[model samples]
Target: MKSVARKLSAVTLVVIALSNGATAFAQSKVTEIPVPNLVIYPGDLIEEGMLTQQRVLKRSIAGMPIHRHEDAILGKEAKRTLIPGHPIALNATREPLIVRRGTLAKLIFREDGLEIIAVVEPLQSGAVGETVKAKNLDTGLQVVGVVQEDGTLLVEGG
Candidate 1:
């Protein structure tokens, strides 16, 4: 009977120690992250003024690409609905599309001091600096080009 009581005491101590450890973890360090001030729908642009700071448990965001800076999210379009006071995931937003699918844009090619410009219909839409496929309107030839900031496609080679 005495041995059983000692074992019970040891188990009680262990339980208490575990409970204390959990309490300490609950009060662990917090990180200040930016969150949306209101509901942000997909395709809506994120603005600096539309964000607010929130304190989150550090461990809760482990291995997550949560946005910590305003500059990282500013002027970006939301890819999913963002609720107020929730940390924004890095993949939740994207650069705004400068060129849309099936849109006619100028395709410029430069080689050996010669520059050639032609009209192209973008087969896919993309943002600046993104590569996409376009069809040359003049020659009906398929080509790959990088989308430019001005919504133009710049082709390389012939």
Candidate 2:
């Protein structure tokens, strides 16, 4: 009778432990950091604390050339004021290319320019009008070409 009672207590303890472990695992959460006010299109050189506005007439005061537009720049403040150029910064929403030297990556061309896609190889250094070698991961083909203003590498072959 004592042995049976011990066995029943051990089973109850095991079930409770398993239930607690399952609850702890299921209650786990992922936290994401808030992005800053910066909008960077592909091929835009990013400086710290720089943002791009969407209007054509609203100029940049920080001597950085405006590359793209944002929705906030279309407000009444932009229309009413004839400010020569406001201080601009890059938006944090856009992800920058992470390229490394001598690593293989795939080049995807968009309407703006090109995007180099590689899981291991991040784009380290590239400029506009400069030729870069991009390799397709699936086909393993090497494509050489010019880097456009929109941050895309225009390969010679299709």
Candidate 3:
């Protein structure tokens, strides 16, 4: 009788241990993450109204960089199509481009208290603080410059 009681207690301990492990596994398998409420196409700016939170299985999004909060997605431009009720990938969005291709932008060069400004055509679109290639309209030369906050390209030594 003592042997049977000992076996029953051992089984109970194993059951308790398994239950705890299952609970932990369950908690890790599911999480709440932000998802788009509507289809978001490339170049569309993400807004607060476009996002909603939903519980998602971790395995479904394994190895993907996903946005967990609505704040991370808002005010960003979509780089790829975002499907509704799915995880938003990190590479699927970007900062909105301030300088667009084929647009005229001011090119500013400053050195030793001297500044030269000229009009240039942007060959590529880029956001503030991004390097972009532009054509100097007056000289017809290709130049690379950093996009400034004021929609100007700042070129160094050019």
Top candidate when judged by lDDT against the true structure: 3
What lDDT does each candidate get?
A: 0.90, 0.44, 0.91
Better of 1 and 2 by TM-score: 1
Candidate 1 positional error at 45, Å: 2.0
Clashing pairs in 1: none
Q: Candidate 2 has what TM-score?
A: 0.25
Q: Cα deviation in Å at residue 157, candidate 2?
A: 5.0
On a 0 to 1 TM-score scale, where does candidate 1 land against the true structure?
Answer: 0.75
lDDT (Cα) of model 1: 0.90
**Candidate 2 Cα outliers beyond 4 Å, as residue runs:** 1-124, 156-158
lDDT (C-alpha) at residue 109 in model 1: 91
**What TM-score fits each model?**
0.75, 0.25, 0.78
User: What is the Å distance of residue 114 in model 2 from its true position?
Assistant: 16
Every model's Cα RMSD, please?
7.9, 20.2, 4.3
- Give me candidate 3's TM-score against the actual structure: 0.78
For model 2, what is the error of residue 130's alpha carbon versus the real structure, in angstroms, after optimal superposition? 0.6
Return the number of clashes found in candidate 1: 0
Q: Between the candidate structures 2 and 3, which one is better when assessed by lDDT? A: 3
Cα shift from native, residue 117, model 3 (Å) = 1.0
